[model samples]
Target: MKIAIIGTGYVGIVSGTCFSEFGHEVVCIDKDAAKVAALCQGQIPIYEPGLADMVAKNMTGGRLHFTTELSEAVPEADAVFIAVGTPSSRRGDGYADLSYLYQAAKDLAPHLTGYTVVVDKSTVPVGTARQVARVISETNPTADFDMASNPEFLREGAAINDFMRPDRVVIGVENEKAATVLREIYNALYLIETPIVITGIETAELIKYAANAFLAVKISFINEMANICEAVGADAIALAKGIGLDGRIGKKFLHPGPGYGGSCFPKDTVALLRTVQEHGVSARIVEAAVEVNAAQKARMVKKIRDALGGSETGLTIGVLGLTFKPETDDMRESPALTILPALIEKGAKVVAHDPQGMREAAKLLPDSVIYVENPYEVCLGADAIILMTEWNQYRALDFKRVLATMNKPVFVDLRNVYEPNKMRAIGFEYHGNGRGHEKR
Candidate 1:
């Protein structure tokens, strides 16, 4: 299979590299010459676990290539994947911005030589595949291509494994030819008997949005439960465990935290809501989840302020993590973005550290935050320590050193990574979410 992927963002780069690893010839195209050059030299722009090594191996094996020109790879390709970004609209309408995606289709129209399958690998709204097809046909009426929808479900920090061992593959096509090409591209997964759901193009597009919205709802539901546990003098961890043990409600997104924040959940949930409302349907449950998620982050600010003796004014607070979750450096919609700024506005001096997100975090966070080189350095002379993201290093911190270094030994565990009883025994004032009954 010869695959040409447009856009070198997270989805495009990962999908293209993984396709090459499957023994398919792949060329990832980006308009940015510098990014293409960096990729060609084995210099990856993003920090995904094991991605750089895989890319290097495939490139060295003559299976993967990167270029800024579409003509370099599009003409002879069996399938051209549009994996560009579909970020939330800047107009505040909660719709996905599809200008980049549509432009990619127009650009690839003239280069289509034979019966090529044009696959939409980006998470997009319903009917986007049809719109892309219309755009390509309008641009080049003589082009021979079929539109297909193959949305990606890659979780950041675990994208490689998710691509290779996906729970299932959902492909949308109008005819057998397009379906056959996509299936052949994923023949490796087919050989392993990976379940593939072939559906209409619209259903495939809606599936991605529905799946993300449901996960967001689950996360918001757990956070709401955590709040109830705090109010009723119960433990959310035990509560989650009790309910999760039920065969019907397995334990996946039930872990309580500040809120759900990442590229997918926040953006996709709003997009889903927008799409539903646009169709004259109501999505009240998803709407409430969005409201609750916003409130959860605000509540975390209050939780920290309460732990700081009713105020954050003039206090030095240490944050252990900045990225939304660990193992990736994506700060888009991270709770730290909201929580830290609110605390800073209340006159708190903030210090933060993340294993891989400091460079990116510095760009999104307020300039007042002091970025530290070491994890423990964030605790130096701080009034309190807030365990924001559960990075591996923060899990087993030298509490003795932290207790000694802090001006006030106030520990606020937002992620509930530590036991409330054990932290209290460690001679520091501890505050954990949904563990009101654990206070001694």
Candidate 2:
């Protein structure tokens, strides 16, 4: 099948590369000439694991291509996927801005030569496919194209494996022909008997929002439990483990942390609530989860200050990890983005290190915060150390070396990377979220 994927962000690049790997002639189109040039030159603009290699191999085999001209690419393709970003509107409302998706449909409309399936691969609001269809038909009334919603469930860090071995595939199409095209496109997964849910466009759109909202709920629930455990004399980790063993509870996203901060959850959860509200419905749980996530990020600031004997003013704090999570450089809505600024405002000098996030983090973070290459160097002459994001590089740090250079031996583990007993035995003041400690 000849497929053209518009936009080369995380979703577009990964989807196009993986589709090409499935033996389809896939061309990813982006308006940015520099990004298209970079892809043609084998310089991938984003950092996703195994993506560059797969794109390279597919290009070498003549299965994949990149282009800036959509008019030329769309005419020759059987399917055109709009994988552009649908970021949250800045109007203080939770609506997902669909301008990019609409623009892609308009651009692809005039070039539709035959029966082509225009698929929405971006995480869009409900009824967006219908809107895209309306836009296409309005632009070119003679264009013969069917609109489909095929939401992606790929995680950022583990996108390739997720694309190849998805939990399931959800495709929404209006007719058998469109369904058949989608089925053929995902035939690789069908061979393994992967469950595919064929639904209406609205359901397909809601599934992505619902799934992300639920995960955000789970994260907020655990963080609230961690706060409760701190008040009581119990460990949140053990509590999570005890409940997680139940088949219904299944232990993912149960670990407590600063909060859930990434491209999807923050925007999707809020956008979902916005959609729900538009339909005159109340999503109290999702609403509470969003509030909790915000409070959790703020709580982490107090956690660090409290660890430093009551205030962050006039203190030097060492931070390990800045990305929202390890294995990716994405800093969008990272807890560090929220927490670090507050600390800097309170006059704390922060030096942080991440294996991959520094370049992106430097732009988002306050200039008062210092960035260093070496993780250990972040701890040099610090009053306290914070284990912010749990990168593998920070997991097995030589604490002996860490404590030697710090002005004070205070260690605050925001991600719970270390146990309280171990840090206490090592002759350092240690604070872990929900690990249970007596008042300072």
Best by TM-score: 1
Q: What is candidate 2's TM-score against the reference?
A: 0.98
Question: Which residue pairs does candidate 2 place in steric collision?
Answer: none
Question: With candidate 2 superimposed using the best TM-score fit, by how many Å does residue 439's alpha carbon deviate from the native?
Answer: 6.7
Among all candidates shown, the one with the greatest lDDT: 1
Candidate 2 lDDT score at position 268:
98
lDDT of 1 by residue, 129-223 (tens): 99999999999999999999999999999999999999999999999999999999999999999999999999999999999989999999999
Q: Put down candidate 2 lDDT per residue, 1-440, tens digits, no spaces.
A: 99999999999999999999999999999999999999999998878889989999999999999999987689999999999999998787778998998998898899999899999999998999999999999999999889999999988789999999999999998889999999999999999999999998899999999999999999999999999999887788999999899999899999999998889999999998888889999999999999999999999998988888889899999989988988899999999999999999989999999988999998989888898999989989999998988988787888888888989999988888886778888878988888764343
TM-score quality measure for candidate 1: 0.99
Give the clash count for each candidate: 0, 0
Model 1 per-residue lDDT at 256:
94
Off by over 4 Å in 2: 437-440
User: What is the Å distance of residue 431 in model 2 from its true position?
Assistant: 0.7
Give TM per candidate: 0.99, 0.98
| Overall lDDT per candidate, in order of appearance | 0.94, 0.91
